[model samples]
Target chain A: MRMAELSRTSGVPVPTIKYYLREGLLPAGQVAPPNQASYDQSHVRRLTLIRALTDVGGMSIATARVVLSVIDAPDRTVRQKLGATIGSLGDIQATGDSGGADRDEEHAQAAKTVDDLLERRGWRVDETSPARAAAAEVLARFDRLGHHRVIAALDGYADAAELTASNDLDVLAGIEDEDELVETALVGTVLGDALLAALRRLAQEHVSGSRYRTPPR
Target chain B: MRMAELSRTSGVPVPTIKYYLREGLLPAGQVAPPNQASYDQSHVRRLTLIRALTDVGGMSIATARVVLSVIDAPDRTVRQKLGATIGSLGDIQATGDSGGADRDEEHAQAAKTVDDLLERRGWRVDETSPARAAAAEVLARFDRLGHHRVIAALDGYADAAELTASNDLDVLAGIEDEDELVETALVGTVLGDALLAALRRLAQEHVSGSRYRTPPR
Candidate 1:
């Protein structure tokens, strides 16, 4: 189908489609002729996934790129994707303001920032290393909390992360294939938020006890 | 100690501290001699937690305010806080973006938009309700995918969220005091991310089958 058809069918604009192509966020369409390209249903589906990561998951473009790389790569494992995503979460966390703005531009800047962070860390990722760079962006946000505080927290977080990762891995190992993966990803995203909410609630019971025992004067 | 001393010790700034006080993000300090004010170690600690949420956890000031409220409110329960946080997450998702800029001003605007959404939802929360508009925000992103494609997905997400919350509540139920709560919060915050990271890794194996049976061509 033509670009317009894809746009009409997908609700993404021609310009935006072009932008994704340029950014390598989307694969190049089949050459129809003289500067025109054709896209198919797969392109539309891919575009939907891209939208899911950036728009719904709040991932920056670079992080989304790494996620896509893993999803698309036949050899990519769940562990790599998780590592990449955990790193990507940091990227999302780094955005100081959750403004409604030019997503494409923000994504571009985020990608560059992620690249700089990976370089600074001396990470051995290729230029196409989306996960490494995505992780770097998250680390950079961790960096922005100021060196001392972030450093203090990073050690504790890393330690805790190891334990949690093991538990989660156990859960994932039970699931079987691609369908389960998407279902699990969807579940994980929402469930993760819910889990935090519940824990915060549960923690409050304990938090409130301090108020009674150590009344402030 | 005075605000300056608190700042030096906690690595928080006087202006930011002032902002917190004005916004009720921080507890009021004791007024000292000659129109001066004094803060104690607890204030410093609270400030640190505030910074972690904002800088590391990427919480908005408004959301931070609500979270702080829960922490400070002596009467709030584990169940209430948990429910509130879950509710707040939905709120945050609801008001995340309305489609606008990529900078601070736009972020502020988006925050305001979220505030509006919470108001519309009639949630008993401040403008800072972290979850006030989060769910809607997530939904909005998927709006581009068209209603039919995402409604079921959203339902699936909600279901998963409920289950995760239940599990997390179980974890929090064991804590007996504030110290434990703090420890739990810390561990949960860090480990939770790791757990999700692990689960996401495992889930990737099944995503292909879950999203659609046919490979995009």
Candidate 2:
């Protein structure tokens, strides 16, 4: 297949495909005798994944590159793909937004809160887990706003997270083919985030309707 | 009261606040005599929310503007605020990334899937809910990838979403003051998304560890 066919089949633009190729996000095609290069089924699949990550998952090009590397590497296993993709997805935020003079005190309190949450949940994760740090950062911000009550919402959030992860891993473990496993892991990591976010929005609306009886003002 | 004080209290840089002011994302502070403008507690709170939405939630300034407007509007009710914020938050992506001729067919199918999902879940939402469209768009992308398997994860994702939203609305309904209510709604809507995403990542790690007994590659 030519580049045009790759774009056509994948529903991605030709220039976008070229951009991914140049950025090394998509592997290069076989250079033919002429100027044209021939793309294969793998190229189409790769381009499809790239679009799903960027357009649906809202991951940046750089982050997508790292995710793809973990997914496509010869030695990449399901564990590496899951760890790296989840970590990279957690990286979709600007650092240092919680700057303040009491930063040290706030961080200390936040760390304790995270630790307490972990201890209560009895989840065995590493000290350096980005999700733990990310959760702590959110708690620190809630403290900053003089809205410590938001921290009370964490347990419910954690319960939902645990249940969802259990479901995800169950589906993952059932896959027999390594290639299918990698593809499922990648798609689930990327588009799966969007799916969850969308459902949450809908649920928010439903709950809000019942919580507040007032009409739209 | 001064710009420096506002920055100190909010932990947001003066220039960023000024940018927000210039961009109308932040309302102008009161202009006192001696060419001095004084910001109050409201400014600090609003500024903090803006930073959370932009930095932590990864929402663009433009989207944040629409959100803040809805939340801070003089005529906004709990109903209006929830509907508008959740709707705008769904606009966090660049629309129409799939640039092929089959976009209409893809969208038609996506819309049906969203409708079916809503009906199955017995969710009560409007015809024009952006969450529905966002979910549809994601399903369409999965279709484009020829990876229909991704849709299988939607039910589990919906379960997590419902639990999180119920928790969020419960916390939100507990606030007595309208100002406090609006603030919590804004912070929770933005930061809550990140918190859930982070928790999901952490849970993914825990599940993956137990699912695959093999070591990381």
Candidate 3:
């Protein structure tokens, strides 16, 4: 397929496809005799994954690239790929991992909170995973807001996460094609985040209706 | 308190406070004859909320403005405020609520999936809500990927959402002060999204460790 057909089929604009090609996010298509280049089925699938990550997953292009690197790495085990991909997709970028005295103390405290949560759950995950860093940032900020009680939701959130993680991995286990497995793993992490966030808001509406219903006029 | 003290206390920069003031996300402090304005405790609190929303919540200044407007309006009911706040914070922006024929068709199909999920869950949310739109976008993209089967996780996702929403509203109900109530309502919606996403990733690591641990070389 030419770029035009690829764009039409994938619903991505030609210029955006060119941008992805230029950024090396999408592999360059086979060069034709002239200036024209031709894409293929792989291009369609990759473009779709990129669009899902950027558009639905709300990931930055750079994050998408990191996730792609995980997908493209041949020597890494599935576990390594999964960990690398999950760790890279974290949205908490501005966290000062190292700072002055007070900030360092807070990060340590939040890190303890994170470790404690993992320990209590008896979940064997790396102590230094980016999720811990991101969660620590959230916890520290909540403390700054004088709402340390926000941490109370952590246990319930963990329960929910356990259920979701189980379901997500179950689906991953069923995919037979290795390429499809990797693709789903990457797109699923990002798109899955979007799905969960959206569903959570919808559920909030359901709760809001009954719990915070407009007081009778 | 003055702007400097407000900045110091809230950890927001003075220039940001001024920008919020100029943008009307923050109200102007009391004008003094010495060409200086004096802010108060409320300014400190509001600045904190603004920074939290913009920084941690990943909210645009414009969206933060919309959320702040809901918080400041006195006439809105509690449910109205909650609904407005949740509705306004959705990160999905490029949804084809208006688009070409094929796009609209896909949206409609995805909308139906959202509807079926809501109906099955006995949720009373409006069909046209943005959360539904966002979820539909996710579903449609998965469909394009030939993985419409990914919707299998919808029920589990919805279950987790119900649990989280209940927990959120439970906490919201315990807050007695109206100002704090509104503030928590807004920040919780955004920050809660972040918290849940982080927790989900951590849970995934746990799941991965057990389910996809790297095989012994």
Candidate 3 per-residue lDDT, tens place, B143-199, comes to 878775478767877888888888777778788887778778777778887888888
Candidate number that wins on lDDT, 1 or 3: 3
lDDT of the candidates, in the order given: 0.50, 0.78, 0.79
| Candidate 1: count of backbone clashes, pairs at least 3 residues apart or interchain | 46
Worst window of 10 by summed lDDT in candidate 1 chain A? A144-153
Candidate 2 C-alpha error for residue B15, in Å? 3.5
lDDT of 3: 0.79
Docking class of 2: medium
Tell me each candidate's TM-score: 0.46, 0.89, 0.90
Stretches off by above 4 angstroms in model 2 are A1-5, A96-100, A209-217, B96-101, B210-217
Q: How well is candidate 1 docked (DockQ)?
A: 0.07
Question: Can you list the residue pairs that collide in candidate 3?
Answer: none
**Count of residue pairs whose backbone atoms collide, per candidate:** 46, 0, 0
Off by over 4 Å in 1: A1-43, A69-217, B13-23, B31-37, B74-82, B90-217
